[model samples]
Target: MSRVINTLDVALVAAAVIAATSLLSNDYYLRIIFMMCVYYLCAVGMNVLVGYAGQKSLGQAGLFAAGAYAVALLTTKTEISPWWALVLAAVIAGLCGVLIALPSLRVKGPYLAMVTLAFGIVVEKLVGEWTEVFGGAQGIYGIRPISWNEQPLTTQQWVWFAVVLCAVAHVLIRNLLHGRFGRALLSLQADEIASSSVGVRVYRAKVIAFVVAAVTCGIAGALVAQQNQYINSDFITFHLSIFILLLVLFGGAGSMYGPLVGAIVLTAIDAALARWPSAQHFLYGFLLLFALYAMPGGVTGALQTCFKRKPKKQRLSTGETPKTTRIGPVASGDLLVVEGVTKAYGGVKPAQNVSFCLQRGHIHALIGPNGAGKSTMINMLTGVVAPTSGSIKFLGQEIADKPAHEICRMGMGRTFQNLRLFADLSVLDNVMLGHHTRMRNGFVSSLLGLPGALKQEAITQARALELLELVGLSHLCEHPAGSLSYGLQRRVELARALATEPQLLLLDEPAAGLNPQETAELGQLLLRIGQCGVSILMVEHHMDLVMSVSDHVIVLDYGTKIAEGKPVEVQANPRVIEAYLGVDDEPDASEIHATA
Candidate 1:
């Protein structure tokens, strides 16, 4: 029932509902609905980037001003149509978004906030100082109201126009939020490094989000300029930017209705408080603080949390799951070849001349002490680092220099040494985040909730559930990954990597800190994952686990592959024993067995 109600359809229905209410009401109510429509459009754009894309913007108001001025100046000074001005304003604002994001990409956290805040101030100052085109502090006035030929728009026409713009913008953004691009943005919020490792161009995704958001704001600005019949720089002040940011946060950061809900609720409150202007802002401040402290997820998010449902993990296959359509020994020869892959620091050896082969459908273990460069080897294999001198080929393709996400899209996936879940999001969303690269829906269709995106989501959710079940984590699907136990988090991480559906899965320290029982379960899980034909390169410190499962073991000693062979043969090698100080006095084979 809920899934059937979507952006365009829902927005149309909502507009109809608002229209019905206004049809039977007085002029006052119509005006209120018009204002609500405008506010909702602005909030929708704010939510797209700051909410869905995981950016914290402080310059949307500046973009809004740019659009308003574009329309004002174009109409007052030239014969340009308002429609063309709106288009030009959108382009100009989008260009500003690109410029702001290019520089903001390198700076994050408070620095990111500061940069954007400064941009808003700078844009404001420029609008005030550029006396040639802009009217400085006086602002451009006498703007012509838009209308059909021979007459300006009536109150009813303006209200309807407001309804249409709001409805259209909402539908557009909603569709975009559910597409591949949306997932990419979510992946950034979830774990940027992991997202990049999965083939998401983080910078590109971010910039696109910024531009989309800016353009949406520009559209809203055009509508506002036409409605008010006057424009001023003060209208797009710093406070307005912060208000929109807080509005997105207050509504719900990752939901279709969050922005609309936030805008409506706040506007209603402001209207009610208009009689007490002195205390109104103070009250808003209090509410903002209260919401942050008591309802951080906002009304929609909190309600969802209260009644959240965990998606069940699919049951494990009985007997055996089907392997990749090959009857050969797991990971048949030379599909993944890393030869003489060497990476070292200024003076310390990190990974010295490492060489190995991973055939498809095999489980390959890379085991070593803390400083043995196991992580480095995994990094190099996944293209997280460029080898000082060496090569890595996946399916006979040189993937050594490609970024991590490209390797993922090329059928390589990985999990980190530490858990990197979106601490704020649920387990289901975490796996969903991992499916960004695999999803086919683009932003436009997703935002529109076209039949294509709906079908695609149904497929994605079903696949995500299957992946969850494969890793035995379906039970906690709705719980935040951060709230799960260490063992469960490890499995969820594995589930996330599975979401990418990679041919080669690289796992770093998969069994670290697990209890004996959990470790046994992990061993079984790894064997099972390998049986599904995912060639695995894993780093583990547990010799017992490695010796039991690894068909081929690469032993690293202080960042160099000193030994590589079947676990049995490598275990018995004299140099391998001495590397671990087993040769103070040489330990016999029997003694080594006894220690094990």
Candidate 2:
């Protein structure tokens, strides 16, 4: 059904372009149509980076120049065919994308934007000042245009060619962005830490997004140069970069049709404003500001709001049991071993000399007062924070220095102390993202939407639905995660973590915001999970839930382990009492337990 819809959309676009080409005889209208296709290509790929991945870039013009210049040099100087030169130009621009993406790993937000802006400035200067190769201000002339057989394409034929490319690009990009890869990008935009916890390689995903944007923008640049039979540094400017960004923002960033909408509407507006050169910059600036503040989601978003439909309530059938499956590597006895872990920042130590072991199929609780480092310990176990000195062994493999995504793939899953749900995504999508590493399909398989990829996606969705049922959230699976109540959002996070199929689960304050009744339900849920052969380690402040569900308990005080034993033993320990009450004298056992 989705394939049919996608085909219909492409067909409609092609039909419209064909109709316009048949009716329009003027060169100006034909050129406008051609430029719209080019800009749409750039906008669609930019949407993947700036829209879905949330990596703001301001140097795409540099990548555009990389493509445009490559084609100009290749067709003018070498014997390479214009078509082959176009492909090579895309490859060259993709490499440039990698160069720009390196800084993104170390910087973000305005700092990352500045880095890309500098790159554009450098490329502009290099092209404008370098005389021998780039032709300086004189620019490259008589560049060969693409041909059909032995004859160069007419203006109408060029428009037809661009329209076909746009159709193909739309189909391919839609396929690429609909499944696992799309969810991964959206998850990264929502929360990088959470994205890694769900098995997304953070840096790798960013690079792929940058490459996607670069390749499409490169194609657009190559097409422009080939059509015009000329290339100049004057065409590549900061204004071009800003204009490309506006294409995404004004049309609706992450929406599938945003590129087409932006390209058509803004291209027409630009053509209309072309006569008033002095007002063009001012109008563009005003539109950009309006898009940012008034229509943040862009034109598509506003339309969605105006025509939104009410979602139907959905639920699992009565008495249907959720299927339970073994997650991670099958192991016996101890599943996680932490030895003498210490994490210190300057004179402040969050965790010092913390040591503990988690037995397979057992539920262990880490309990502490405020600032006792329970969350820090969980962070270290999940590889979110590197310990100053420690050894972490999961399933007998040393993983102290492994990245978070690596640890997750090794069958460790965790939830944050604070909620980190991808708010814009549906609850089902959040869970499906957790199954990212488990899917067997490669990038090519996913990009082309092969049968294997489709099958795996179906299996992932089925598994996610079952997990939602297990957590009593199947009814709300279609709703946005952020729209759910606090307790429901917690359940969604748990379901998402469970989808990772981890042998060991580390939960930080899972019961923090729940009422007493909800806390009890959560205790029961943890027990059910433990019975499925998964080891559990939770950092929580609710003593009632801890006492009821914990098989063993470790208590922390001022960055040090104060007690480790059965829950009853830890609850009655004098040191634990003193740590909680901050008093030298031992309190009554019941009083200490109540205080905790």
Candidate 3:
């Protein structure tokens, strides 16, 4: 029934667009709409890298020019069909993207921006100076109209042509933005090392993002050239790239409708504001300043913020109803097995020949002196850093080489020593990102709001809120995660990790910087989580909390284990005492007696 409704909805949209195309006949309005479509196409390309992939490229104009020139030369100077020229243009531009993206892999920030800027200048100059091939600064002219069935298209026909192609591009981008590709891009955007550690294919994701952006630019260029029937070096200027970037940014970089929104806003403004010869710079600058202050999230982001909602609390039944109903099978036996693990950076060793195992429902403590390699051991086990040597078996499988995402999928999740929440997003948004990892919806299915995606999103929202409530962070759900107090941020990070429903959770310094009361609360929270069958490996300096909560303790100093047993056994060991005091220092023989 739902699928049938969706099919009907799509048919209605197709019919509406066909009808609207027939009605929009004014040349000025048609041109505005066409330019909006073109800009939308360009912004979508930019979004693949800028928004989704977290790459900053100021060189899109170079790719756009390469594409335009490819088509211009093919149609005007050669015998290739315009359709074939479009295809070749996309390929050429996409290859150019591959070339630029290679160097980009090694550089970021100002360095990357300069690299792309230089590339754009080179492309523009070559097109102008290479007269034999490009017809010099004047550019090749007399390109034929886009023809299908050998019929030259009219202006009205071309407007509709632009509309159809841009619509197709939008649909494709929407799908790509929500699927495996989208997740890969977003993951890399957040943390490259973490993404790679999680099996995201970082290098491949970067190249693919660049290629997709280039292809979209090529298509937009072809449409623009065909619509104008005249081309020049000026058509693909460096300013054009900057303009497209600003447009996407102003429309909400994360949204599919962002490009369309940006295109309409800017095209209308530019066309209207162009008539004031001397006031152009001042007017445009003022507009940008206003946008920066008033709508920094861009149109879609602002809208999302305004419309954001909390998961509604269920009205309790008349009798015995509870909030949580654990539906999945609980983990059994040992949840995580660590055997003979060692890690070294350069000549510095962190963990040496350490072994431990965590049961399904216990808090395992990893404690040590400042340099004991406690954090280093966690890094190795979680795949943040490769171990010098060792094996990690989780949930009955050898998971030593698994990526972080795969580790997460295999029921092992982790929190960093330093909180790494998506700071710019709301607390709820941050949790939603974690929920994204658990979802099974494809990109295509998500955009169509497939029955599965809708149901899954609702469940994810409910679960996320429930986890937030457990962490005592439910009230701050609408606030930006970064804006929260330090204690609150840590809990939010924990809530995010919990959203993945891990069987084994590795927490590094979770109690760091918390007040005594907060620490006590956290201790209780850990106990409650343990009762729910999630195993824990905690690295903490909060001795009171550690001694009170952990079922088993592992002590280390100078990158080597000094003792392993129950908390009391580890606390009483003389080797642990000596490791803490160093070789020459006598254990205060009096306090040592009490410790014993």
Clashes of each: 12, 0, 3
Candidate 1 least-lDDT 10 residues: 321-330
Q: Which wins on lDDT, candidate 1 or candidate 2?
A: 2
Q: What lDDT tens digits, residue by residue, belong to model 3 across residues 527-557?
A: 8777666788999888788889999999878
What is the TM-score of candidate 2?
A: 0.97
lDDT string, candidate 1, 60-106, tens digits: 78878877887887778888877677788778878888888888878
Clashes of 2: 0
TM-score of each: 0.89, 0.97, 0.79
Error of 2 at 288 (Å): 0.3
Worst 10 residues of 2 by lDDT: 319-328
Q: What is the alpha-carbon RMSD of candidate 2 to the true structure?
A: 1.6
> What are the runs in model 2 whose C-alpha is more than 4 Å off?
316-325, 328-330
How do the residues 459-541 of candidate 2 rate in per-residue lDDT, one tens digit apiece?
Answer: 99999988888888888888999999999899999989999989999999999889988898899888878877778999988
> How much is the lDDT of residue 410 in candidate 1?
81
* Each candidate: RMSD: 3.4, 1.6, 5.0
